[model samples]
Target chain A: MRAVVTVMLKDGVLDPQGKAIGQALHGLGFPQVGEVRAGKVIELTLDERDPQAARVAAEQMAKKLLANSVIERFEVEIVA
Target chain B: MRAVVTVMLKDGVLDPQGKAIGQALHGLGFPQVGEVRAGKVIELTLDERDPQAARVAAEQMAKKLLANSVIERFEVEIVA
Candidate 1:
Protein backbone atom coordinates (compact mmCIF):
# COMPACT_ATOMS: atom_id res chain seq x y z
CA MET A 1 0.00 0.00 0.00
CA ARG A 2 0.99 3.61 -0.51
CA ALA A 3 0.39 6.38 1.99
CA VAL A 4 1.08 10.08 1.64
CA VAL A 5 1.62 12.38 4.59
CA THR A 6 1.20 16.10 4.18
CA VAL A 7 2.74 18.19 6.91
CA MET A 8 2.21 21.92 7.20
CA LEU A 9 2.92 24.61 9.73
CA LYS A 10 0.17 24.92 12.31
CA ASP A 11 -1.92 28.05 12.31
CA GLY A 12 -0.35 30.94 14.26
CA VAL A 13 3.12 29.50 13.79
CA LEU A 14 5.85 31.61 12.22
CA ASP A 15 7.22 30.34 8.91
CA PRO A 16 10.32 32.29 8.01
CA GLN A 17 11.32 29.83 5.32
CA GLY A 18 7.97 30.17 3.70
CA LYS A 19 8.21 33.94 3.84
CA ALA A 20 11.59 33.77 2.15
CA ILE A 21 10.18 31.54 -0.56
CA GLY A 22 7.36 34.00 -1.19
CA GLN A 23 9.82 36.85 -1.61
CA ALA A 24 12.03 34.74 -3.86
CA LEU A 25 9.07 33.92 -6.06
CA HIS A 26 8.16 37.58 -6.27
CA GLY A 27 11.69 38.57 -7.19
CA LEU A 28 11.64 35.85 -9.86
CA GLY A 29 8.78 37.75 -11.57
CA PHE A 30 5.76 35.92 -10.19
CA PRO A 31 4.30 39.23 -9.04
CA GLN A 32 0.74 37.98 -8.91
CA VAL A 33 1.63 35.57 -6.15
CA GLY A 34 0.85 36.52 -2.59
CA GLU A 35 1.70 34.70 0.63
CA VAL A 36 3.49 31.41 0.06
CA ARG A 37 3.71 28.77 2.77
CA ALA A 38 5.75 25.62 2.42
CA GLY A 39 5.26 22.11 3.76
CA LYS A 40 6.47 18.54 3.46
CA VAL A 41 4.94 15.56 1.76
CA ILE A 42 6.20 12.14 2.77
CA GLU A 43 5.23 9.28 0.50
CA LEU A 44 5.45 5.84 2.00
CA THR A 45 5.25 2.53 0.23
CA LEU A 46 4.31 0.17 3.01
CA ASP A 47 3.86 -3.57 3.35
CA GLU A 48 0.39 -3.12 4.81
CA ARG A 49 -2.43 -4.05 2.44
CA ASP A 50 -5.44 -2.49 4.12
CA PRO A 51 -5.97 1.20 3.37
CA GLN A 52 -7.27 1.93 6.85
CA ALA A 53 -4.30 0.16 8.42
CA ALA A 54 -1.89 1.98 6.15
CA ARG A 55 -3.47 5.33 7.02
CA VAL A 56 -3.22 4.62 10.73
CA ALA A 57 0.39 3.55 10.40
CA ALA A 58 1.26 6.57 8.31
CA GLU A 59 -0.47 8.88 10.77
CA GLN A 60 1.58 7.39 13.55
CA MET A 61 4.74 7.88 11.54
CA ALA A 62 3.80 11.49 10.93
CA LYS A 63 3.16 12.17 14.57
CA LYS A 64 6.22 10.32 15.81
CA LEU A 65 8.90 11.33 13.36
CA LEU A 66 7.66 12.89 10.16
CA ALA A 67 6.37 16.10 11.72
CA ASN A 68 6.81 18.38 14.70
CA SER A 69 3.46 17.89 16.35
CA VAL A 70 3.63 21.09 18.35
CA ILE A 71 4.19 23.33 15.35
CA GLU A 72 2.98 21.31 12.41
CA ARG A 73 -0.16 19.42 11.46
CA PHE A 74 -0.24 16.40 9.20
CA GLU A 75 -2.84 14.71 7.07
CA VAL A 76 -2.46 11.18 5.80
CA GLU A 77 -3.85 9.85 2.55
CA ILE A 78 -3.90 6.21 1.54
CA VAL A 79 -3.10 5.99 -2.13
CA ALA A 80 -3.03 2.26 -2.68
CA MET B 1 -7.68 31.92 -4.13
CA ARG B 2 -5.32 29.21 -2.98
CA ALA B 3 -3.01 26.96 -4.92
CA VAL B 4 -0.88 24.03 -3.89
CA VAL B 5 2.21 23.01 -5.78
CA THR B 6 3.72 19.63 -5.03
CA VAL B 7 7.24 19.00 -6.22
CA MET B 8 8.73 15.51 -6.24
CA LEU B 9 11.93 13.98 -7.50
CA LYS B 10 11.88 12.21 -10.81
CA ASP B 11 12.19 8.44 -10.86
CA GLY B 12 15.70 6.92 -11.00
CA VAL B 13 17.22 10.02 -9.43
CA LEU B 14 19.28 9.41 -6.33
CA ASP B 15 17.43 10.45 -3.19
CA PRO B 16 20.12 10.41 -0.51
CA GLN B 17 18.19 12.70 1.80
CA GLY B 18 15.12 10.52 1.66
CA LYS B 19 17.21 7.42 2.22
CA ALA B 20 18.80 9.02 5.24
CA ILE B 21 15.39 9.92 6.58
CA GLY B 22 14.23 6.35 6.14
CA GLN B 23 17.29 5.09 7.96
CA ALA B 24 16.69 7.56 10.74
CA LEU B 25 13.11 6.39 11.03
CA HIS B 26 14.24 2.77 11.15
CA GLY B 27 16.78 3.60 13.84
CA LEU B 28 14.01 5.33 15.76
CA GLY B 29 12.24 1.93 15.96
CA PHE B 30 9.61 2.33 13.23
CA PRO B 31 10.59 -0.91 11.54
CA GLN B 32 7.23 -1.44 9.90
CA VAL B 33 7.99 1.53 7.66
CA GLY B 34 9.26 0.77 4.17
CA GLU B 35 10.52 2.94 1.32
CA VAL B 36 9.97 6.61 2.01
CA ARG B 37 10.12 9.51 -0.44
CA ALA B 38 10.11 13.19 0.44
CA GLY B 39 8.77 16.15 -1.48
CA LYS B 40 7.77 19.79 -1.14
CA VAL B 41 4.37 21.38 -1.07
CA ILE B 42 4.09 25.08 -1.69
CA GLU B 43 0.84 26.74 -0.74
CA LEU B 44 0.11 30.07 -2.37
CA THR B 45 -2.55 32.54 -1.44
CA LEU B 46 -3.15 34.47 -4.62
CA ASP B 47 -5.10 37.58 -5.39
CA GLU B 48 -6.89 35.91 -8.24
CA ARG B 49 -10.36 34.68 -7.46
CA ASP B 50 -10.81 32.11 -10.19
CA PRO B 51 -9.66 28.64 -9.29
CA GLN B 52 -8.58 27.78 -12.85
CA ALA B 53 -6.52 30.91 -13.16
CA ALA B 54 -4.98 30.31 -9.76
CA ARG B 55 -4.02 26.82 -10.85
CA VAL B 56 -2.53 28.06 -14.09
CA ALA B 57 -0.56 30.76 -12.35
CA ALA B 58 0.71 28.32 -9.74
CA GLU B 59 1.73 25.89 -12.45
CA GLN B 60 3.81 28.60 -14.06
CA MET B 61 5.40 29.32 -10.72
CA ALA B 62 6.24 25.64 -10.31
CA LYS B 63 7.70 25.38 -13.81
CA LYS B 64 9.77 28.50 -13.50
CA LEU B 65 10.87 28.62 -9.88
CA LEU B 66 9.18 26.33 -7.37
CA ALA B 67 10.61 23.17 -8.90
CA ASN B 68 13.81 22.11 -10.61
CA SER B 69 12.41 21.02 -13.93
CA VAL B 70 15.33 18.75 -14.75
CA ILE B 71 15.05 16.43 -11.78
CA GLU B 72 11.58 17.12 -10.42
CA ARG B 73 7.98 16.94 -11.50
CA PHE B 74 5.36 19.26 -10.02
CA GLU B 75 1.62 19.01 -9.66
CA VAL B 76 -0.54 22.06 -9.01
CA GLU B 77 -3.81 21.96 -7.13
CA ILE B 78 -6.15 24.90 -6.60
CA VAL B 79 -7.66 24.64 -3.14
CA ALA B 80 -9.68 27.80 -3.00
Candidate 2:
Protein backbone atom coordinates (compact mmCIF):
# COMPACT_ATOMS: atom_id res chain seq x y z
CA MET A 1 0.00 0.00 0.00
CA ARG A 2 0.95 3.62 -0.38
CA ALA A 3 0.43 6.39 2.11
CA VAL A 4 0.94 10.08 1.60
CA VAL A 5 1.65 12.36 4.51
CA THR A 6 1.35 16.09 4.17
CA VAL A 7 3.10 18.13 6.84
CA MET A 8 2.32 21.80 7.03
CA LEU A 9 3.17 24.52 9.45
CA LYS A 10 0.37 25.46 11.80
CA ASP A 11 -1.59 28.65 11.45
CA GLY A 12 -0.02 31.70 13.10
CA VAL A 13 3.48 30.37 12.43
CA LEU A 14 5.81 32.53 10.40
CA ASP A 15 7.05 30.96 7.16
CA PRO A 16 10.03 32.80 5.79
CA GLN A 17 10.45 30.42 2.89
CA GLY A 18 6.88 31.03 1.85
CA LYS A 19 7.33 34.75 2.16
CA ALA A 20 10.36 34.66 -0.08
CA ILE A 21 8.52 32.66 -2.67
CA GLY A 22 5.58 34.97 -2.65
CA GLN A 23 7.83 37.98 -3.05
CA ALA A 24 9.69 36.32 -5.85
CA LEU A 25 6.46 35.53 -7.60
CA HIS A 26 5.40 39.14 -7.36
CA GLY A 27 8.69 40.28 -8.73
CA LEU A 28 8.42 37.81 -11.55
CA GLY A 29 5.31 39.61 -12.83
CA PHE A 30 2.76 37.49 -11.00
CA PRO A 31 1.16 40.42 -9.26
CA GLN A 32 -1.98 38.44 -8.60
CA VAL A 33 -0.21 36.18 -6.17
CA GLY A 34 -1.08 36.78 -2.56
CA GLU A 35 0.06 34.96 0.55
CA VAL A 36 1.96 31.73 0.10
CA ARG A 37 2.51 28.86 2.51
CA ALA A 38 4.96 26.05 1.92
CA GLY A 39 4.86 22.51 3.25
CA LYS A 40 6.22 19.03 2.64
CA VAL A 41 4.78 15.84 1.26
CA ILE A 42 6.14 12.42 2.01
CA GLU A 43 5.07 9.39 0.02
CA LEU A 44 5.61 6.10 1.78
CA THR A 45 5.44 2.66 0.30
CA LEU A 46 4.47 0.24 3.01
CA ASP A 47 4.06 -3.48 3.32
CA GLU A 48 0.81 -3.00 5.21
CA ARG A 49 -2.16 -4.00 3.09
CA ASP A 50 -5.21 -2.84 4.94
CA PRO A 51 -6.21 0.76 4.25
CA GLN A 52 -7.36 1.46 7.80
CA ALA A 53 -4.21 0.01 9.30
CA ALA A 54 -2.09 1.84 6.77
CA ARG A 55 -3.73 5.14 7.68
CA VAL A 56 -3.14 4.51 11.36
CA ALA A 57 0.48 3.59 10.80
CA ALA A 58 1.09 6.54 8.50
CA GLU A 59 -0.48 8.93 10.99
CA GLN A 60 1.74 7.50 13.68
CA MET A 61 4.76 7.96 11.46
CA ALA A 62 3.80 11.54 10.82
CA LYS A 63 3.36 12.21 14.50
CA LYS A 64 6.51 10.47 15.61
CA LEU A 65 8.99 11.27 12.86
CA LEU A 66 7.72 13.38 10.00
CA ALA A 67 6.20 16.35 11.77
CA ASN A 68 7.16 18.71 14.55
CA SER A 69 4.01 18.78 16.62
CA VAL A 70 4.73 22.08 18.27
CA ILE A 71 4.57 24.05 15.03
CA GLU A 72 3.35 21.66 12.37
CA ARG A 73 0.23 19.68 11.57
CA PHE A 74 0.11 16.57 9.40
CA GLU A 75 -2.51 14.72 7.40
CA VAL A 76 -2.25 11.14 6.20
CA GLU A 77 -4.04 9.76 3.16
CA ILE A 78 -3.94 6.12 2.16
CA VAL A 79 -3.69 5.31 -1.54
CA ALA A 80 -3.38 1.98 -3.21
CA MET B 1 -8.86 31.59 -5.05
CA ARG B 2 -6.22 29.21 -3.82
CA ALA B 3 -3.85 27.11 -5.84
CA VAL B 4 -1.83 24.17 -4.63
CA VAL B 5 1.34 23.14 -6.36
CA THR B 6 2.93 19.84 -5.50
CA VAL B 7 6.48 19.40 -6.71
CA MET B 8 8.10 16.01 -6.63
CA LEU B 9 11.36 14.51 -7.79
CA LYS B 10 11.21 12.45 -10.93
CA ASP B 11 11.41 8.73 -10.49
CA GLY B 12 14.94 7.27 -10.73
CA VAL B 13 16.40 10.39 -9.15
CA LEU B 14 18.22 9.88 -5.88
CA ASP B 15 16.55 11.34 -2.79
CA PRO B 16 18.89 11.30 0.16
CA GLN B 17 16.38 12.92 2.49
CA GLY B 18 13.82 10.23 1.75
CA LYS B 19 16.35 7.47 2.15
CA ALA B 20 17.33 8.80 5.54
CA ILE B 21 13.73 9.01 6.62
CA GLY B 22 13.09 5.42 5.56
CA GLN B 23 16.11 4.28 7.49
CA ALA B 24 14.98 6.12 10.57
CA LEU B 25 11.56 4.60 10.32
CA HIS B 26 13.04 1.12 10.07
CA GLY B 27 15.28 1.77 12.99
CA LEU B 28 12.35 3.08 14.96
CA GLY B 29 10.45 -0.22 14.51
CA PHE B 30 8.48 0.43 11.30
CA PRO B 31 9.69 -2.66 9.52
CA GLN B 32 6.87 -2.45 7.04
CA VAL B 33 8.09 0.78 5.56
CA GLY B 34 9.37 0.46 2.03
CA GLU B 35 10.45 3.06 -0.48
CA VAL B 36 10.01 6.65 0.62
CA ARG B 37 9.94 9.81 -1.41
CA ALA B 38 9.82 13.41 -0.31
CA GLY B 39 8.31 16.37 -2.09
CA LYS B 40 7.03 19.86 -1.44
CA VAL B 41 3.67 21.57 -1.53
CA ILE B 42 3.12 25.26 -1.91
CA GLU B 43 -0.24 26.83 -1.31
CA LEU B 44 -0.74 30.14 -3.03
CA THR B 45 -3.52 32.58 -2.34
CA LEU B 46 -4.24 34.30 -5.59
CA ASP B 47 -6.27 37.32 -6.50
CA GLU B 48 -7.65 35.50 -9.52
CA ARG B 49 -11.17 34.28 -8.91
CA ASP B 50 -11.59 31.83 -11.78
CA PRO B 51 -10.37 28.33 -11.04
CA GLN B 52 -9.12 27.73 -14.56
CA ALA B 53 -7.07 30.88 -14.60
CA ALA B 54 -5.74 30.11 -11.16
CA ARG B 55 -4.62 26.69 -12.31
CA VAL B 56 -2.84 28.10 -15.31
CA ALA B 57 -1.12 30.78 -13.32
CA ALA B 58 -0.04 28.33 -10.66
CA GLU B 59 1.38 26.00 -13.28
CA GLN B 60 3.35 28.84 -14.74
CA MET B 61 4.68 29.69 -11.31
CA ALA B 62 5.68 26.09 -10.74
CA LYS B 63 7.50 25.95 -14.02
CA LYS B 64 9.24 29.23 -13.60
CA LEU B 65 10.10 29.32 -9.92
CA LEU B 66 8.82 26.41 -7.87
CA ALA B 67 10.12 23.35 -9.66
CA ASN B 68 13.33 22.36 -11.38
CA SER B 69 11.95 20.84 -14.53
CA VAL B 70 15.05 18.77 -15.19
CA ILE B 71 14.66 16.71 -12.04
CA GLU B 72 11.18 17.49 -10.79
CA ARG B 73 7.59 17.57 -11.96
CA PHE B 74 4.75 19.61 -10.58
CA GLU B 75 0.99 19.38 -10.38
CA VAL B 76 -1.30 22.34 -9.89
CA GLU B 77 -4.74 22.18 -8.36
CA ILE B 78 -7.06 25.12 -7.84
CA VAL B 79 -9.28 25.49 -4.81
CA ALA B 80 -11.76 28.14 -3.95
Q: Model 2 over residues A2-77: C-alpha lDDT tens digits?
A: 9999999999999999999999999999999999999999999999979999999998899889999999999998
Compared with the true structure, what per-residue lDDT tens digits does model 1 show for residues B22-74?
88878877776788889999998998978888888888888888899999999
Per-candidate Cα RMSD to the true structure, in Å, reads 1.3, 0.5
lDDT of 1 by residue, A1-80 (tens): 88889999998899898899899888888788888789999888888878888788788888888999999999998985
Give the per-residue lDDT digits (tens) of candidate 2, residues B1-80.
99999999999999999999999999888999999999999999999978988988999999999999999999998887
Range of the 10 consecutive residues with the lowest summed lDDT in candidate 1 chain A:
A28-37
Fnat for model 2 comes to 0.92
The top-ranked prediction according to TM-score is 2
Model 2 residue B67 lDDT? 100
> Residue B2 in candidate 2 has what lDDT?
94
Error of 1 at A37 (Å): 0.7
In angstroms, how far off is A74's CA in candidate 1? Answer: 0.7
